[model samples]
Target: MTDESPAFPPPPPPMGAPAAPPAATPALPWYRRRWWKFPAWAWLTAAVVLIAAGAAGGAKKDEDNASADTTVESVADAATTDAPPTATDAPTTEAATTTTVAPTTTRATTTTRATTTTTTSPPTTAAPQPIVFSGRGDDVVNLPDTDLMVATISHSGRSNFVIWALGFDLQETDLLVNVIGGYSGRVPVNMNADTMSLQVEADGDWTI
Candidate 1:
């Protein structure tokens, strides 16, 4: 009279003891299964290294450019502020001049007579003419190669000379002509041809 419960497959192994279902295959993660995570870490490290190197290179380049700019600015300032004009900076041109002076000679005759003498020389140099160029140097030009002289002079006391010849001198020899470029001794230069006379002005040594 049975009505007894069916076996029901041994009650499904007691609801939790079914041998753990083969351990679920351990669920190998995306990184462990495909080995792609190793490459990804490598790529990330390489990217970081490249970024650091690029930054360092850029910094070095910027430093170099800054140094060069500073050098150029300093040079320009020195040239503008420190350097003054000198004689060797310009070309010399020939100027025409004439002079007549009367001198008194005393002889034993108890009477003095005034003797007049006429002299001619090149006109004294006037103030240095301003010439502009891009850079600093010495330049020469002319047909007879007179001089492209630049000089600086210094004088303390005043003298009673009429024409103070202050400039460089051109000394000629027998065989070859020597160029002595410097300040000359101050000498007197007078004129009687015309009323107005020309003279060279300098602040350095006056050459003969």
Candidate 2:
């Protein structure tokens, strides 16, 4: 027997000769390989379980996204819809204006009038003068023409006293007074007399 454990490497071939292959390692058995140690049924069940877990994870992600979108839509609707007004949104008003009125006073006026009196007197009138005619016995007297007048025929005699009148030519004649004792009476010398001549018959003086 030769020495089986040689410590030195193999010698190279000549410069032109092809190198020889390294020694081949011995192969392991199928049972000892890592890929074929378990049964086929275990692999088939594990593959099916892995596929199912992937599908379930995808479906759960989709459900979560849809729930989140629905919650966001609900929040948006609550924010945009109608609502009652608050105290801060109400309108403000100013205070009312105040006015004062003044009172008025009235005064009355009075008027006075003065009265005066005047005295008046009537004018003085003088008495008319008496006409005088005197005769002692029967006589004829021409009487002056006069206006309508009333005169007293006065005789101062105890015997008969007579007064008569005559016209211008002594044709018209009339008896005026015939008296016995002292006589004082009145007679009217009017238009019919016409200032005629008068005849007086007396025992004493006679005047008119």
TM-score of 2: 0.38
TM-score of each: 0.24, 0.38
Q: Tens-digit lDDT track for model 2 on 1-208?
A: 3333445667878898898897554455555556656679879998999999999999999999999999999998988775556657558798999998878877777777767778787887886676667778788877777666676788888999988777777654667789897998888764575656777889988887
| Candidate 1 off by > 4 Å | 1-38, 86-208
Residues 1-208 of candidate 1: C-alpha lDDT, one tens digit per residue: 3222343423235666655443223344444444454567877888999999999999999999999999999999999898776657567788978787889887775777889988889898897564322211222211122233322222322332112222233221111111243322322222221112123232233322
- Residue 7, model 1, lDDT: 34
For the record, the alpha-carbon RMSD of candidate 1 to the native fold, in angstroms, is 51.1
Q: How well does candidate 1 score on lDDT at residue 159?
A: 34
